[model samples]
Target: MLMHSVSGVLIILVLIATGYWLTVQGWFDEHYSKITSKLVTQIALPCYMINTITTQFTRGHLLKILPDLQFPILSMTLLFGLSYLVQWFFQIDPHHRGLFKSMFANSNTVFVGLPVNMALFGKASIPYVLVYYMANTTFFWTLGVYLIRSDGQTHPGFNLWQIVQKIFSPPLLGFMMGIVLVCLQIKLPPFVESDLHYLGNLTIPLSMFFIGMKLAQMGLRNIRPSKDMAGIFLGRFLLAPILMTILVLPLTVPNLMKAVFIIQSAMPVMTNAPVVAKLYHADSNYAAVMVTATTCFSLIMVPLLMMMVMRLV
Candidate 1:
């Protein structure tokens, strides 16, 4: 299991490296990233998540893992409070505070994290991954959105319908529907199911390609960690994972789910950080740089952490 898991992480790193090289070679640019981002967010990811929930998730699985949601909720809630306190103590800039809080609290759970979980724990791990997915998604859209907006960038502000739309996003709807279907035990026809399985498989490679394109846009030479950046790194690569793992120790859930939660919690910053930052008029460049740094670090940390988690269970 360790060897296979490590190999998966290595393969993902290679993809990042290849994407970097492609950018240098002029094969990827801003346009490529823009298109890929749309594809992943609107199509591939929703398909991947919907397929996973419908096919792999069951009432039994949900019943068993439901209690485990608090791990991420508590860990993120603690880190968020700590992040805010630290930012306040150090007097972080108003523009960047929200980005910093998000960097610490919410992870790239659905996109990059899901792929890694697929690699390490396989199809069966999706239900467990969804635990983090649900929690992180909740924090991300609500508190995460608020932090970005709180940077005091003028947004159109919130409308009740808009908030509802954001909360019940396509992926979340896919997840909820999957639960409904699962509880009723309705299976799709074999051919249709096979097609969803195939279409959903496109998410991993597409997501990695999008990351590579973003790396190209940012340029590797430009990535230099500042004091705040250092804090962000610790919150993401080191503190968040360690804290999540420790919190999971006493959980009565399946051993593999515990490990899955730890690894998912440790995933790099969300790929959408820059976009969200830009929307809220925050420091988009800082978001991009942090995303690059933490992602590179995770190539090593995620696999190593998984190996340790395998021992703990």
Candidate 2:
């Protein structure tokens, strides 16, 4: 277990180190990183998510989640509170609290979630995870956006259309199209599914490399890890998932579902947290620290936590 954890951590660190070196060496510019993140978010993530959702939301699949949504929601909400609690305890400025809230609730669902799942469970678990992420996307963009508006900033005025816009955003639209395909009972020819499988698999490494690129852009020099930052790291990487695992694993969740939920929770703070922080004039630095520390730490924490969960189950 320890070895597995160490290997996972080392791989991620090496990727980051390589990325850092490449940027320092001027192999890629910030424009390159932006394009990479854009491709992942606008193209790769949506396609993979749509492919998974189409398969899972089929005739019999949609109604089967009666009890399943509970744990995910509970876990998400719990982590949300814990993250906010940290901000309050730390006495982070009112401005930064929103960023802290995002760190607690958002997670690295793509880069870390995909690779870790394939390593710990298998390709079969990917569809279930896609659903979880699809749902998470909605919550993160909507409620998360709302939280960051502060100091009498004109609230973007609650807009359901905006939420729908997020859902219909390229990545999510793919998932929606998948659902339509499933409902229409149109199976992709074997060749297409095969193509999807091949393309979808690229999600893992590409996303990881994107993380590497972001870390390179931030680098160690730009980020000074503060105690408040450390708290967000611990909360996301260690504490929140640990709390979720205890609640979800003991329930009758299938081993695969349990693994997905637990591992997803274990992912690093969501990249959007910082974006939202910057948007609302919150503590973007704190959000950046949360991103860096959690990204660095989750390499070890995720695998070790997975091993423990597997053993307990």
Q: Who wins the lDDT comparison?
A: 1
- Count backbone overlaps in model 1: 0
How large is the C-alpha RMSD of every model relative to the true structure?
3.5, 4.3
lDDT of 1 at 250: 77
What would the TM-score be for candidate 2 when compared with the true structure? 0.74
- In terms of lDDT, the poorest run of 10 residues in model 1 is 1-10
lDDT of 2 by residue, 201-284 (tens): 556555555555555666667677576676677677777677777887667667778778877877887755544444445554
How far is 77's C-alpha from truth in model 1 (Å)?
Answer: 2.3
Every model's TM-score: 0.79, 0.74
lDDT of 1 by residue, 61-96 (tens): 777877878888998998898898777766767778
Off by over 4 Å in 1: 1-3, 89-93, 108-127, 145-153, 250-257, 272-285, 303-311
Residue 54, candidate 1: C-alpha displacement in angstroms: 1.1
